[model samples]
Each structure stands twice: as structure tokens, then as C-alpha cells.
Target: MAKGVISAADQAEQLKQDGNTYFKKNRLGAAIDAYTEAITLCPNIPVYWTNRALCHLKRNDWTRVEEDCLKAVQLDNKSVKGHYMLGLALLQKEKYAEGIKELQRALDLGRGAHPNSYMVEEIWQELATAKYQEWERDSTKRSWELRRLKESCETALEEKYSRDDVSQKTDDTDEISNSTSEQLAALKLVFDKAAEADTPTDVPDYLCCKITLDIFRDPVITPSGLTYERAVILDHLEKVGKFDPITRETLFASQLIPNLAIKEAVEAFLEKHGWAYKMD
Candidate 1:
């Protein structure tokens, strides 16, 4: 209560931490604002400049990032992070010679200070490989560079989602597979029932159509109060005459309604004696 005013160093440090928090949350604009405020409060902090450069890098503002990273290096020539970010920015802008120089410098510093840093990631290895591959063919080198671009994108995605709870990922693959299997089983059952109705046995006279003299694939009724297979009845109406073959009564093919009950009985019979269908 007595000392309400914050010290400049403490305030700047707090702002820098706020920027880090915002950056972690992917609020790049807010993070940049916080880092800029921190830099204004404490211009000598090279890390603050480097942190702001990282936010700009996220936005793909390579020019702005290059400027910030260059300033960070000017303040602290030994800043490995500053050189790394500057190298990435220049590389993104296709300034390969300058970018490679800065990256090699960062790699050299990283080897001395921290051997297991971002410089050891696949991106660096791929670039190094691509630089050498360039001697063989320009197209092959471009392909490697394209892979590097994709590698950077994947790295950014990893950074964003690395903290997410992977355990909560709802996998519906089993459910979909089971559902498809069940549907196919149901379809097979229907086909089996239809085929079983054709079993070898003395079928009931009513179940057999007079035209084909066999069980119906699709049974239909006529205006003359007789049922027959649809194809047989239609053939008789079109080829023979528009009259019932057995009853000799005038009938129309358009009068056919599905004999669903008969069809079900036939299907049940065929299901029981599928061998009879082979005999037919």
C-alpha cells in the first residue's frame, strides 16, 4: 500500500511474461503488442526483441521479423535465438545465401551453448541436405525446398497443438467399421432368403406361375384374379395377347399389384432349401 508504483525493470519483466503467455495461446497480435510495450519499457532487453520477432514470424511478416531479429542480434551478437529467427525469416523470403550464413552462425553458437536446441530439428537437416542436393540438379533442390516449406508448416501446427489433450480424441473408426459390416450382413440375409425360396421341392401350384411354370422372381396379380411372375405376365401381354393364360379372361399388365405375402413365403422356402434353386 505504501509503494503502489511498480519499478521499471519489474514492469518490463511482467510485460514480457504477459507476451509469452499470449504467444503460447496463439494470440500473436496481443503477444506482439505486449512485447512491443516491454521493449519500450526496456530497450536494452534483446530477448524482448527476439520474442516480438517470433510473433511476426507466426504472421509470416518476414520483413518485419528480419528487422526485429537484426535488432536483437545488434543488442546481443551472441544471441543464438536472434540469429536463428533472422535466418528463418531470410530463408522464407528466398535469400538463401544470407539465410544460410546466419543459420550456420546460429548452428555454430548452438553447438557451443545448447547442443539440443531447435537448430537440431528436421528443418535444419533438410535445408542442409537441400543445399548439398542443389549441386546435383536445381529441380531436385526445389523439391527439397518444397519439403522444407511443408516441414515448417507441420512444425507450426505442432507448436499450436502440442499442449492439447490427445487422450480426449474421439476415434469413431470402430463404430463406422461395425456399422458397415452390420449393413452388409443384413443385405446378405435378404439375398439368402430370396435364393432359398428356390429350393428343390414340389412347390405349391399357387406359388408357381402358369406362364413360366416355375416359382416367381417377382410375383404380380392381374385384373383376372390370377398371380404370375411380372416378366412372364408382361411377355404374355405384349407378345401373346392381353388376356390371362390360365383363366382365358381379359387382363391388363397395368393392373398388377405386388403379391408381397406370396413373395415372402417363396423367399422363406428358398432360404430353407437353397440347393433346390440349383436344381431349377
Candidate 2:
């Protein structure tokens, strides 16, 4: 009986090795079957769980991938592959915040020794993309709010001027005219300052570009390149400036604006160029 048991254990070990070979060949279904058989023969082995997790990942069975990864981690909390697999599985589910935390934990646990730099970089890139997307959404909301505020201010000014004109017909002529002129002067000053503030300052264009690129290159927040995010921000700023009366002309024609001042430059360019934009 003991001899038979020992022979069965040896067979299970052979089956596990065969599963690994199949996995290496990208024969995921066959690898899964072999790993499953090995687990039945020796359910205590952590290798079986780990190998099965790899097959599940290749098949894009994220739930099973997560299950097997947790099992492996339970068996050996120190397993770097276990934590990495969990993070990848969570990321695929679009649970970005949780996925980032898990990936960061994997890195903190000294998983850098693993020969998977490309995979690690991909994970980091995903996290960065999520963060940048969040930021873009927030910026959009603020732009809309600023547009509404400008419209409200304009409406209030119009209402106040209309009231003053009606009152001027019934009040002292000289006093009412002087008051109207003083108010108009103050309003003109405010409008002039707003227009002047729309253009970019003296910062170098290249420096602005470099700073924007660096923001997108951050491993934790912006893993991907800056092209996509930068384009989106520029496009949005252009739209906002065009629709915003106070900022429209001032943003379009400024020669001193830096190319890297993407937001401010777009506003200035739109204002200077009479808010004309090609949709293509």
C-alpha cells in the first residue's frame, strides 16, 4: 500500500511538470487539465494552484485567475507571482483603485526580483491612465462651472445697467450721467484685465511641453505617453475658450504664448484667431 502511494505521488509530480510544459507552449486548456489532475492527486501542493492560475490568466478567466491566485497566496504569502497575478486579475475587472493598491503592494513586497519588467511597466501604465482619466473628468467639470460663472456675471451686469438707465430718466441729469460713466469705466477696466490675463506669461514653450510630458510620464499616475491626454486637454480648452465670452478673443492672437502652455496657449490662440477651430 505504501509503495503504491509513493508511486502515485511520483505520477502527480510528473503530471505537474507536463502541465508546465503545456503552459510554456501556450496550450492553456491542456495545461489546465493537467494541473487540475495534479491537484486531485496532490491537493496540498502550491505549485498546482500557481500553474492553474497561469492557465486561467491566459484564457482570460479573470474570476478563476483571482481564485487561484488567492489560493496560492494563502498557501504561501511570500509568493511574488501570487500577488502579481491578483493585481492583474483585479485590473482586468476595472476595479482600478483596488488594482493599483494590490500592484503597489506587490512592488513593496520586493517583487522586483522577478524577471517581468515589461509586465510591471504595463500594470503601472494602466494605473496612470486611470488617474489621468479622473483628472480629465474633474477639469471638464471645472471648465463648465467657470463658463457658467462668466455668463452669470454678464447677465448681472446687463440687469444692473438696464436698471440704472431707467432710473437716470427720473433722477438729476448731471449726477446720473456722471455715475453711469464712472460705472462704465470700472467695468471696462475689469474686462481689460480679464482679457490681458488670458494670454500666457514669459515661460518657454519647450519648458512647458517638457513639464506636461513629465506629468504624463509619472510611473504611478501617468504611465503612458502624454499624447492622448495632452490632445484631450487642448481640445477641451479650445472649446471652453470659444464658448466663453470673456476669454474668447484674448486667448486667440497672442504671440508670446508658449506652445507648451497647452491650456493657456489654446485659449490665447482661440481668442487671437477669432475663436475659429477646425473640427478635423
lDDT of each: 0.72, 0.59
lDDT for predicted candidate 1 compared with the true structure = 0.72
Model 2, residue 278: C-alpha shift (Å): 25
After superposition, candidate 1 runs with Cα above 4 Å error = 126-280
Q: What ranges in model 2 sit over 4 Å off?
A: 4-9, 110-280
TM-score between model 1 and native? 0.46
**lDDT tens readout by residue for model 2, 58-171:** 888999989988888788776666777787788788675676666666654543464235455455455445434434444456556666766676667667666776876766
- lDDT, model 1, position 192: 50
Considering summed lDDT, which 10 consecutive residues are worst modelled in model 1? 271-280
